[model samples]
Target: MDLECSDLFEWHMQSGHGKVYADSFALFISIPLASLCVLILIS
Candidate 1:
């Protein structure tokens, strides 16, 4: 997961549109993932 994130970051840094897409994409993915983690911990 970390490696994938790093790769995405590197790819995004190489392009303007990719950077915007990556930032929003990361936010979208991370919110759901973080909520899942919290739910697991609460359970």
Candidate 2:
């Protein structure tokens, strides 16, 4: 039972990390795209 609980905890932690990584990647991509759009509008 304890081992199962630990495994579940680890799985949740990994999933949380994945979500954070994906969010960071999306933000990185969006910031560059937004900057490009702004530059195009200015020019």
Candidate 3:
């Protein structure tokens, strides 16, 4: 199981999907946090 997980991870990094997913994930998380920060500053 561990080996399979590592293999998949390597494939993702090599294929460039890893970077895309990471960027999207960062945006997904940051957007909500940013909005919350704005709301706090306004209030």
* Best model number under TM-score: 3
- Deviating ranges (above 4 Å) for candidate 2: 1-14
Alpha-carbon local distance difference test for all models: 0.90, 0.84, 0.90
How well is each residue in 1-43 modelled by candidate 1, as lDDT tens digits? 9999899878878987887887899999999999999999999
- Which stretches of model 1 miss by more than 4 angstroms? 1-14
Q: Model 1 reaches what TM-score against the true structure?
A: 0.62
User: What is the TM-score (0 to 1) of candidate 2?
Assistant: 0.62
Q: State TM-scores per candidate.
A: 0.62, 0.62, 0.67
lDDT of 2 by residue, 1-43 (tens): 9999888766855885867766788899999999999999999
Per-candidate count of clashing residue pairs (backbone under 3 Å)? 0, 0, 0
Worst 10 residues of 2 by lDDT: 9-18
Stretches of candidate 3 exceeding 4 Å from the true structure: 1-11
Residue-level lDDT tens digits of model 3 in 2-40:
999999877887886898976888899999999999999
* Lowest summed lDDT window (length 10), candidate 3: 8-17
Between candidates 2 and 3, which one is better according to TM-score?
3
Output the better candidate (1/2) by lDDT: 1
